[model samples]
Target: MSPTPEPGLPARVRVHEVGPRDGLQNEKALLPFDVKAEFIHRLAAAGLTTIEATSFVHPKWVPQLADAERLFPLLRDLDGVRLPVLVPNERGLDRALALGAREVAVFASVTESFARANLNRTVDESLAMFTPVIARALDAEVPVRGYLSMCFGDPWEGEVPVDRVVRVARRLIDLGCAELSLGDTIGVATPGQVTALLTALNGAGIPTERLAVHFHDTYGQALANTLTALRHGVTTVDASAGGLGGCPFAKSATGNLATEDLLWMLEGLGIETGVDLDRLTGTSLWLAAHLGRPSPSRTVSALSPKES
Candidate 1:
């Protein structure tokens, strides 16, 4: 038999930090607006190029994001950084646009069960609703990112089919979305599953380079799964600082993978995240102390220096 080619080098991955928005939103105490701005400032200082700042979801739905109108302008005009927010519908997009939001993300769920619960709309209905939102953004020369939740497993449904995931990804790409972020809303994906999904997405001519992984560390497998995704030539993994965030409608724990942890693994693997571990970990520790709990990331906790 002919010799197989050596395992080629993996592509460089970009970690978009989402901690300031996703990380702090779920906290019961609800961080003050100033603290939220500071959190974002610290993340940018830590060298994160992209950060999902906040969502324009109604205050009744997610009270933590009530300050979106105020926070967006404060963070949007920062020099040399991209801050995108989650806009649920046309109304939300209107708010974001009025705030001069150039980049925004539209979120939907892969499974019908997740869609109904998260957005109170069916899969097709949600897509139909987002069509105008996407169209308007494109017309305005704005960049739009699509988010697909429960690409792996859902709390209500045991496991989602691979075909379903592929279809949703294709739809999002076809909707003029420049990028798609696959979300593990329940945090149940294994390394094998991560590889399989990315492989399928790559095979479908869906441009894996434009893909981003939004993992939840519910089972503590977020970092390991990230390694698998990186190996499969998938870049732009999303992470929240202090391992913060959880889905409101989703049943299981769905906190995001910690930025500090993701950076630790990437650096150890000789991957360039351009994020400073000490500064990030320092911020993580500082935030945790404010929240009055230890962080969930093993890497962050392991490399965490003594608090002075």
Candidate 2:
């Protein structure tokens, strides 16, 4: 594949849309299954090839996505899209497998505080637990994506070390994850920090091709960090439609890098993401109305035509 228009970027970037699952998970109002299904359908129709549909986590933990079992069945008609769901443990993986999930994602944090708060396990313990889960997914022929949260900074621990992040990431990749998504959970990462982290990962021999970046727009640095990652040759990026979803564990964490926002930049840079920005913006606008608030995405706010 050719490099992107930017001197060192990839020719085409693959955007992994996490809106339906991630976006709605953080909402105060619980949407009906039909509404969630429609949103997923609209997102896929807007040219997102990989849309994370839902998570198989226990309802007690995240009441919003308790409908995962019911939701996946309704998404069968979305034929060509890859709908990966988050599976936090063996039970979650089992639930996903029973529902015929072809791709699943597992999440862990680099900081011990985050690991304990989020999963009730230490960083090492969480990694140990995922080993079996990842093995099971691989045995079942399902591609597993490992999500390393708190890659740049942690709310409880402050600035996270790059080596700590790299160690956890290496462990995940070694444990059979097909790809690793480094997440700035608190949205506190700057472009310089992003560069240093990627550089360290590269030095550790993990090619950018096996990685994706997940950034929060909390400090309004998501796009800048994404641009740095793209320059480093990382092609896959995780974004939520309509700027939905925030870290429940991190109080200061606001929202993800919006799909519309990322699309606007990609479109301007002449990068082929196969996404229709106009259609995506329309989706966000519709979702905003349903959520009873304006979208946080600058691109969506700027591009959406006003009602007469």
For each candidate, what is the lDDT?
0.84, 0.91
After superposition of all CA atoms, the RMSD between model 2 and the true structure is 2.3
- Per-residue accuracy of model 2 over 227-275 as CA lDDT, tens digit each: 9999988999999998999977777888999998898888777789999
- Kindly list the per-residue Cα lDDT of model 1 for residues 32-99, writing each as its tens digit: 78778888888888888898889999999989889998887778557888888888999999999999
Estimate the TM-score of every prediction: 0.94, 0.97
lDDT agreement of model 1 with the native: 0.84
Name the runs in model 2 displaced over 4 angstroms: 1-5
* Count of clashing residue pairs in every prediction: 0, 1
Q: Judged by lDDT, which candidate is best?
A: 2
